[model samples]
Target: MNKIIEIVSSLDTNQVYAELSHPNSGGICVFFGAVREFTNNEQVTGLEFETYEAMALKEMNKLADTALEKWGLNKVVIKHAIGKKEVQEPVVVVGASSAHRSACFEACRFLIDTLKETIPIWKKEIFKNKSVWVSAHP
Candidate 1:
């Protein structure tokens, strides 16, 4: 397959390079979304992610297909981690490989942005005393 779409409990960057590498591609672009230490000046202890698994997978597959066709990508990988994650832990990873740098660069951005806007995944920010479920967009 030209694409890999999955919702995982953990994200492994080591596998990303192999997954996005293609002989026809000159460049691969990757974006890793991680749990940050702070949000809105509040210290974030960690994060919890939840998703409608069936729908999230469907949307992710659609994104990979669209990116492949639109950018002529040789390979695509989209993954998101569920459950709890500590600060600095990767929450999601998206990548694309194309014949040149431009296509992969733009496709990588599109894949992540569109996924955040449309996918059924939700995130909760954990603080010292309380937790808040955050919207997909700010």
Candidate 2:
């Protein structure tokens, strides 16, 4: 398929390269959002992500379609993980493949930035002592 979009409990990077690889594509760009150990100097234990799956999936498909049309992308993948994620684990992955570097690069960035702005995913920062719900946009 030309597009892959899903909200998963776990993310697999091994499939990404193969998924985005196309004979006509001269360039592929990917962005991964991972959990960090600290946020604003506070020690973070992990993060929790929750989303309305149906809505999120629909929004993701829309974003992927837009990127594909706007950039003439050969392939596109948009995925996000839910539930608790430890530091260093990938929370989201966005990628694009096109005939040239610029299109894929630009599309990759647009897929991620637009996804953050439009998707209904919410994240909670897990601190050593407590958990705080951050903005839903991330």
Using lDDT, give the best candidate's number: 2
- In candidate 1, what residue range of length 10 has the lowest lDDT sum? 129-138
| lDDT by residue (tens digit), candidate 2, 1-138 | 899998999999889999999999999999999999999999999999999999999999999999999999999999999999999999999999999999999999999999989899999999988999987357
Candidate 1's residue-wise lDDT over 9-122, tens digit each? 999889998999899999999999998998999999999999999999999998899999999999999999999999999999999999999999999999989998999999
lDDT of residue 50 for candidate 2: 94
User: For model 1, which pairs clash?
Assistant: none
Off by over 4 Å in 2: 136-138
Q: TM-scores of all models?
A: 0.97, 0.96
How many clashes does each candidate structure show, in the order listed? 0, 0
Q: List all candidate RMSDs to the true structure.
A: 1.4, 1.7
